[model samples]
Target: MAIDGFTTCLWFDGQAEEAAHHYLSIFKNSQLGHIVRYNEAGPGTPGAVMAVEFVLDGQKFMGLNGGPQFTFSEAVSFQVRCADQEEVDYYWDRLTDGGEEGQCGWLKDKYGVSWQVFPTELLKLVTDADPAKAKRVTEAMYPMHKIDLAALRKAHAGER
Candidate 1:
């Protein structure tokens, strides 16, 4: 019973391998892991990909070709804690390719996985002890697709 970490499982219709590769391309410190394929079990096409294991940014994930019974929603999202605006932009641009952007630094990738890409500074600004500053920063975030750290800072400072 040595649980060091948890592996997130992503359910896909039939694109587990493709999804794994797509994620691997985005993260620099990532690599492919084991790939399991269906055989005579007959759940999926014989020889078709059943699951793919991959590590992205040191976190383990599994993509399962579990058919179309389930889907990803905004309720569950991966948060990318960026060091600065540049990191935020990098992730936002890459993840939003062939995907949809949502308000407040959220986006759904081509594989329909939701992600929150925001600067780490956002947490500090929005949690400031000054209630008005915190409120302003949070309000400024509402209309943003990709977070603008400078804008958030301005809002936090009550600058026009």
Candidate 2:
């Protein structure tokens, strides 16, 4: 079989359809796909969502309304690279609606999904050819709860 992109399967207690709709609204290129329901061979009640396929920014994911046995954690996260500080701030504010914020540009969404909203320029500066500048960028990045591209650039340039 030819292997293409892998679909991330998320197990929810009973909010698969709602979550799918919410995600589709957030991302630019997203839509809900096939929603399979249970008949008799599945777990939980007989008419629940067995699987709901959704596409977010061209990435496909499958949500299963399985009984609550496991949950999402910070171990896995999705990163959104933004062109500027405004873009970063926009996503950060929207994604952390009902979730906690972590250090270094990381935030949890209302669904408990971890997300990293970062500026594209920050990555470029961190990977610059100058090792000392890169080190400065690294140091600046460590103490930040939310990523500030201007601060990172100042640090990279050996400024206060």
> Could you say which candidate leads in lDDT?
1
What TM-score should be assigned to candidate 2?
Answer: 0.90
* TM-score for all models, in order of appearance: 0.96, 0.90
lDDT of each: 0.95, 0.88
User: What's the C-alpha lDDT at position 107 in model 2?
Assistant: 86
> lDDT tens string, model 1, 9-116?
999999999999999999989999999989998777899999999999999999999999999999999999999999999999999999999999999999899999
Distance from true position, residue 122, model 1, in Å?
0.1
Top TM-score prediction, candidate number: 1
Model 2: lowest-lDDT 10 consecutive positions: 41-50
Clashing pairs in 1: none
Tens-place lDDT digits, model 2, residues 76-158: 99999998998898888878877788999998888888899999898889999999999999999988978999999899999
